[model samples]
Target: MKSLRLIFCALWTAAFVSGCGAYSFTGKSTLSSDVKTFTIRDITLSAPSSYATISQEMTEKLKEYYQRNTKLKLVPQNGDISIEGSIVDYRTDGVAASSGGDKAAMNRLTIVIEVVFTNKFNEEDNFEKDFSFYLDYPQNQTLQEAEKTLVPKILDQLVLNIFGDTVAKW
Candidate 1:
């Protein structure tokens, strides 16, 4: 009986340790063992054609984000999961009025992205939707001056929303 109790305790400890490894602190992933790879196609810019590099930057940012957050392999094509999106809108609007005039004191830079996510393993989880975010800047700051700092912040929010929808399903 003493040896049996020792064996049972050892088995329980092994099972608990292995189970803890299956949990993720970030986004939840319902991916099966066979669904191991993903593909993110080139993101297009339908918003402002003048900023030619925006699309490429967004694409690279998202790819790098997924690589950092998930264990899925990045594939060129025919992956178990696929994400394709476009920057549909990029514009600035006045949000806060000036202290003593009709002029604006603060402006908001908004970016609208349209994403389509496909899960080959579970067709029920597929979706196509718009993910948009914004940043506020003082009226003194020109859009050009703000673009460098604001674009990344906006993209980060969009990435988080998409990640939640795909993995966490929230």
Candidate 2:
């Protein structure tokens, strides 16, 4: 019985080691090595409005994500990696037109962001990209409040999308 226990332990250790070597979390490890610390500069707003505050909120959330999910640290100034960008566009349009060609019972908010990710070490070309997101607002709800609620959720998804595309290589 002791010999059998020993063999089982050996097999388990081997399997664990092999698993670590072979495993890859596609969207989780893209910047694993090139970036040790990251700095997200203030995001520029396309048009001035209450939404301007959303930019700073997004920066903080992204920094938190990196801190929690990766080994990367968040630096105040120059760091191995940096992200800077602007809010390029913001618009609200009607969704689902009515039979009379009028705006229907819902509206859509579209936010577009232009971003650049730089590798200070010159490990690769700077990444410049644009991404957008849309959310439907019920006709009865206040646009202002809806906008406020959507900002964080939109920022969260945008962060995931940006990181996955540029760093995660997804």
Tell me the lDDT of model 1 at 43.
93
Q: For residues 24-77, could you state the per-residue lDDT of candidate 2 as single tens digits?
A: 666565554666887888887875444758778867777777677767788887
lDDT for predicted candidate 1 compared with the true structure: 0.86
TM-score of each: 0.82, 0.79
Report lDDT per candidate.
Answer: 0.86, 0.77
List where candidate 1 sits over 4 angstroms from the true fold. 1-25
At residue 63, give the lDDT of candidate 1. 86
- Summarize candidate 1's per-residue lDDT along 1-170 as a digit string, tens digits: 99999999999999998988866665465577777889999999889632557888888988888888778899999889899999999999999999877888999999998999998998987899999999999999989888888888888888888887876555
Scored against the true structure, residue 155 in model 1 reaches a CA lDDT of: 83
True-vs-predicted CA distance for residue 42, candidate 2, Å: 1.1
Poorest 10 consecutive residues by lDDT, candidate 2 = 22-31
Pairs in clash, predicted candidate 1: none
| Residue 84, candidate 2: alpha-carbon lDDT | 87
Alpha-carbon error at 123 in model 1, in Å?
0.5
Best model number under lDDT: 1
